[model samples]
Target: MKRINTLGAGCLARALAFSLAAGGLALPLSAQAADLPAAVAQDLYENGGVEHWLPKAEKGDIFAQYVLGHMYCNGKKVEKNYELGMRWYRKAADAGFAPSQLAVGTMYFQGQGVERDRDEALDWFTRAAEEGYARAQSNLAALYLGEKGVEPDYEKALHWYGKAAAQGHTVARYNLGMMYAHGLGLDEPDYVAAYGLLSPLVENGHRAADELMQSFLGEMDEEELVAARELSEELQAQDRMLVALDQRAANR
Candidate 1:
């Protein structure tokens, strides 16, 4: 099946980088307590409430700036103008907005509105990742893993995956689980860790993730299966606790 790219050039592009880095395997996010990025909020304003936000986007507001960028980039509400999209995204990204940096970076990566430049893509991803943008971290990790714009390094891949994983990015968790399951990065195979990472996503209705997890586990014996199941139970409990904590945090 053709993978459904995430909305906008920013988040989905980051996921594309992760997909390439992890050799086109599944990657999951770990849940986190964080506010939406200004660019994302801008997206909502434009797409969610166009009448109210269109003028704001046209007036150089950072949130609206990005919404205008997406509008021009995809020609959704206005004339399709790569130059306009590029112009707006540059403004926001230059102001140190992480998502805008990523959005512009994706354009460079794909040569959508700008020249295709892997070097530029690296620059943008690095900027966003340094800001603790999980998608950018995953994307950077993929670049390292695939040697796309830099040297191939499994260790670097693990490092970035861990970064995104900590933020509850599904793709990062899924890739980390696969790495543990296959003994690709760490010293020994770690089915326990794999199950700990994956079971939550499978239960969360990620069909592709569920299939991948099942296939990976197919090699295990009955004993291993039982252990994995036990691990799943433990992870589920932990997930429940995490959810409770998240609710409390939000309430606070």
Candidate 2:
């Protein structure tokens, strides 16, 4: 399977797949944070996985609770237990940990440890996304793109995707580019917009973006191409700025 960014599992727990695939334990990283974040991050790496985190989580450390949730959900160190995972996630999420809010939202969306409720998922996701969590923003954008039993709201989708893409979320950038290509939620397709977004990915050898970009060559005129090229430069600059901002905040 292609490892595109966003939450690998239907826009859920952002780093759960990475930890599972790596055969190790780690904390989920957030896009924006002050002392690193208004989200769960950092500390879990130093003390260790389940053993150490369990105590901290119990003592009301939001970061530890969030990491503990991942371990339980993925069966990293402890046996897989969805109920336990949800409990941990809820604890941190209750404390306004954005990553755990995402995890709780994922569970609600997927019915992993709780009854599936799309509205509940939306509520949780909205909370985290509003907190400027990039993964949650991407996930919320996807939902606004219309999941089962939900209405598609292109404007809302674009808003969330724009936030995430600016923060360097690859999947959000690709999806936004694709929306431009297909005119999803728009009056007409914006070839220049699509080209601006996809062109760099193509340069970087992103196969999906390359294939989509190839389709554009036949559709766009010379002027559109020039405009697209300029827009691409601008978008790339914005991406660099946002990424640097995220890094500076993370290192703070």
Candidate 3:
């Protein structure tokens, strides 16, 4: 597979100064939670509405700003106002809150309230990704994989996917597996790698992975199936992916 050029001009790696952390990955978030940065919004909103977060957001609390942003954007006890949401998100984002950055990037990507700007979206995603935010990294990879204004950049996509996958991001791992299954950025599809990457997810009840496997199974022959089983067995013995993550973090 073609690797992303980290040193390329205007690449997502412009924020590569930060090093990966050495630690076991957190338990993966549900796909829905991974897609949006509002996993905590409901809980926060239930605990207190906009009235609770307003003063703190104004006091320059990034967490409060983020919660306030979510409430406004989601119309939780307040009218939906993308502009107000963006305003609060920007405040926290400017202060380097990863979730807020993801929120702002998502808004830009979706053209919510603000004019849709792919470049701006990429910028915010890159910022949060630099902070080792897995969702931002996954979103960044998706943008690089396919976006209107941005040309498909497979190397960049793979790079960010690996970064996010190393953090136990299900969506990133699924996307990376799909790319391999289709031979994208590679000489040919590698069923072993693809199946190995996805089988665990399928076993874990990822409906999408199970659906994809329906198509993929027809393509793999007996020998490939054997290889895939061996890969699975090896994973049970030692997690190669986690080791790779550790090495990358150690190097950093």
Residue 131 lDDT (model 3): 92
lDDT of 1: 0.62
Tens-digit per-residue lDDT, 1-252, candidate 3: 333222223322222122111110111212223434474645453566777889888888887887677767777678878899899989989999887887788788778879988788788889999998887787777767664456888878878877887778777888776765665555566666667777888899987766665556776789879977776554433336746433423543
| Cα lDDT of model 2 by residue, 1-252, tens digit | 211222123322221111111111233332222224432345434456677888888899887777778888877678889899899999989989887887788888778889998899889989989988877888788778775456989888877877888888777787777766666666566777778777777888878777666765777789878977877887887546345323422543
User: What is the RMSD of candidate 3?
Assistant: 9.4
TM-score, candidate 3, is 0.72
Model 2 pairs in collision = 33-36, 33-37
The regions of model 3 sitting more than 4 angstroms off are 1-46, 217-224, 233-239, 242-252
| lDDT per model vs. reference | 0.62, 0.69, 0.67
TM-score of 2: 0.77
Q: Candidate 1 or 3, higher TM-score?
A: 3
Q: Count the backbone clashes (under 3 Å) in each candidate.
A: 12, 2, 0
Q: Any runs in candidate 2 off by more than 4 Å, and if so which?
A: 1-46, 239-252
lDDT winner among the candidates? 2
Q: Would you list the rank order by TM-score, best first?
A: 2, 3, 1
